[model samples]
Target: MKKIGLAWQIFIGLVLGIAVGAIFFGSPQVATYLQPIGDIFLNLIKMIVVPIVISSIIVAVAGVGDIKQLGKIGGKTILYFEIITTLAIIVGLVAANLFQPGAGIEMDKLNKTDINSYVDTAENQESHSMVDTFVNIVPTNPIAAIAEGDMLAIIFFALVFGLGISAIGEKGKPVLAFFQGTADAMFYVTNQIMKFAPFGVFALIGVTVSKFGIESLIPLGKLVFSVYGTMLFFIIVVLGSVAKLVGFNIFTLIKTLKEELILAYSTASSETVLPKIMEKMENLGVPKHIASFVIPTGYSFNLDGSTLYQALAAVFIAQMYGIEMSIADQVSLMLVLMVTSKGIAGVPGVSFVVLLATLGTVGIPVEGLAFIAGIDRILDMARTAVNVVGNSLAAIVIAKWEGKFQRNSKPKSQTTEILNVN
Candidate 1:
């Protein structure tokens, strides 16, 4: 018998999980017994993320012989990230205005979760200024940065360390070689961990469905639908156009990333798929230097889906409470989101934290968050998948622009094989 493909395994797991959860809705055993499979899978991924990121960034940066080219790629990547992300926020705002998803919604009728946790996080965020954010990027203790998994600090340290290696010329070879090996080993670890994805997806989806059930989404169905619909539109219309310009079919790219996308959606965490996406991008012919740098950096800067959802959700909350936001106020919300959303990219429950922070600044009640907290996981699933896709495409587009893209004629065959050691 032919073995099932990984994507199919995950898909089946997803379907089965939902079916099982629905069959045993409100059963404590579903979460009490079955949830740990998913937790273990997430922890395993988290355990390796810092190392994979540090090694990959250092190796990619050190491999860049031309410092000017490195600067060019960085500049162009950031520009692309900003432009696309801004457009995403605008599209989301426009959709909210048109759909008015929260119009006619009664705040009292909806179930409100305890939002004090999110509020506390947001309050803490308020005290930290943007200048502090930039300065903190240069870690006081690189070791502490890695131990804490501060991505911005780790990225900064890796870039400086890599550049120092590059500056020493021949002496840098040994350092570069070490990171290259570390990155390879981490990629291998990622693959080994991915082999358990089907079980993880099954457990994660099962617990989510069993606990929340399909009914939880009905009260806020309009908001849920609006968020999903806008994300679909963004991916198909906006990111699709970019793919067309880059000389590839967006559908093809999606097909190539089906496993990562499904895993991301089921897990509701893009970090689960980051290492795999980076590997897949390299397999799709994005250079390691570009894929490594662009994917990680894009996670921080190019959160198109998150920003869009934030815009839509912010408006939805306003409409729910009969609060009116002026055009200037909405634009101001976007500007604040553009800043607050950056460094908090891969943090768990990040959207809530960001929304909490920005909601009050624009006069939307912080308590308004409780309205959607129940459905946040459902919304998060969509955004996480889109984020993985967006970051992958960012790397490919930047690679194509830099004349570094080498489209594999045998992607199916190439992706399953181990990366070339030489």
Candidate 2:
């Protein structure tokens, strides 16, 4: 018999994990045992991420052959990211106003999950002005930036280094060849790492379910459902429309990204799928430079799902406290979120961090975060999946816009549109 595909392996793992966790609910020991497996898997992915991103960016930029075109692509990618993210914030705000999930919430009925950790994190995080943000993108020490996994700084350094190499023409061939080999090695490593994904998904989901259980979802069901529903709407209507305008079906892109989405959703970490997404985008005819540059940058600037959650969470907290924000106040809140949400793309639990910062500024109680802390992981799963999809589509759309998308005549996608012949 033919073996099952990776997507199905992960889907099965997800299902079994949920079943096992439900069976073993209220058993902290089970979660404790399974948690390490997931942690190991995550560490393996984290170990390779910085190197893969660095190598890919350098190779992609060196291969671009024209620094002016590279800059043009960079500018267009940022513009696209900004437009899409702004739309996400607006959609999220609109959903929060229309649904008012927290309107009838009773403070006494809510579970008070300790949010001290998040609050402390928020306090320790220094808010950067726009000028400071721009300045921080240039690393003083590129090696230190890589050590800290500062993606923006690393990208900046790689772009300049790649351009310098390209400028030297024949003399730069060896440098270009070295990075090309590095990119190939990292892609192969990414493939090997992905083989462990199903097991990781199983462990992660099992632990998550066993620890949190369905009980934690009860008190804040409205808020959880609202966030999920809003995200689904944004993905289908907003992202789908954008894909249609770009002359491709969104479902086609989704089909291609099935495995990556499953991994991202189960892990609630989009970074896990970055290298794989870049590889797959190349398969779908996005040029390597565009995919590498756009996807990494999108993680920072094009955080549609996170920005949407921030807008909704801010409004949800205000409603929970019976605080009414005027139109002008909400507009101001959106403006704050727009600025505050950048520079936090791939950080763990970033949505909460962004929300914590935005809430205090908008006069909402930061402590309200405790109410939804229990359900954040569940919501995070959806958003992470959406983020992967958003980035994937961004690469495709930008490639098509640049007249670089190479369409297959067969039009076959990984998850759908396959044909069989006798």
Candidate 3:
């Protein structure tokens, strides 16, 4: 018999959620009751983000002797991420154009979004141009950024701090060692936390769909389908194509990443899976240097899913408004999306923030966000899964490109068991 694992359990959760949502369509008591279970689980995942990010970054950055290699890896990662992300956006735009998800959208009386609720003015986001974007990475205050989970700032701080640790030479060894220890400990914590995956998935999906119901998706079904379809294509086609180009079976990579993807889907936070991905990559023969450097950095920078969503949502909103943007305007929007998507931290709700930033850059109405707010939790699963897959592939591909990949020369073994990778 095929072993029934956490992924299978999550599948059960999704199936049951669909059933329960359709069953008790509007019963406030059942819906409200299930809602908190999901909320608590999401909180659990979010609780792990900051420490893991800090520990992983410090550990990854400190161990490297040649900081110049960091630039090389960074360049390759951004280049690959941008190429795939732009393609992802094009896929989204194509799907939206063909399906016309917004053609029938009744924007007559726009339901005003609680725009401030999602906006991150965080004094740190003032950098609207390229120079500011690069400079904004250097945190004005590292403590505040970590406390607030401003990822770009945190990444900038970690890189600088790690460089400082390396500069300290022998003195830095102990501190770098400590971060590695902390990273390992966090992975342990992640593993322990991930034992809750099946239950969390059960609670999360059970609660979200149960509370929201199918009717919430009725008006936005086409949009949801198109966007998700675009993401699925990116995941299978884009990622798979890249994997093939890198000389590995994409199926094996997916199988290797199944547990992480499922946990990411359930928690909807890629940060929780950082330690796990690093460990998996190393085990699969990706250099420790590459695994450490690439995976965590990719979390903060290479957000393929968010990129795809920005393009789709921008066009959907424009279509809804009957505003025909010129080809030049769309090209400009692509450049903006490329920059903003990289800056999104691997945290919950950041996608919407990136979406808002993309809209602001293009002068699109932010109110369009409210249209999908009700079903966002659902859309989040797909996006987060795509992000995890995209980040994972980017790390490995760039590692291979940089001569960091060590082909598994052992007897061919399809790794089947899903370890607790939060």
lDDT per model vs. reference: 0.86, 0.85, 0.71
For 1-422, candidate 1 gives per-residue lDDT tens digits of 99999999999999999998899889999999889999999999999888888887777676665578888998999899989989889999999999999899977888989977767778776665667777888999999988887888888888888778777776667667777778778888999998999999999999999989999999999998999999999999999999999897889899999999999999998889888888889888988778878888888788888999999999999998888889999999889887788777656688898898888889998788897998888999999988888999999999999998988732222211212221
TM-score ranking of the models: 2, 1, 3
Candidate 2: Cα lDDT at 53: 81
Each prediction's TM-score against the native?
0.94, 0.95, 0.85
- Candidate 3 local lDDT, 1-422, one digit each (tens): 98788667767776776677668766776657776876676677668766766766665566665579888877887677668778887777777677777776786543344656777641234245556656767887889888887767776787778778767776776677677667667767877776776666666666666667777777778888987888888888878888999987777888888888877776566765776777677778776656666676666667778778778878888888777777787888878777666654743477677777677668777778877676777787778888888877776798789876776622111111101110
Give the range of the ten consecutive residues with the poorest summed lDDT in model 3. 413-422
Better of 2 and 3 by lDDT: 2
Ranked by lDDT, top first? 1, 2, 3
The TM-score obtained by model 1 is 0.94
**lDDT per residue as tens, model 2, 52-137:** 88877776776666878987898889889889999999999999999999898888887778876666656644365556767989
Find the 10 residues in a row with the least total lDDT in model 2: 413-422
For candidate 2, list the clashing residue pairs, or say none: none
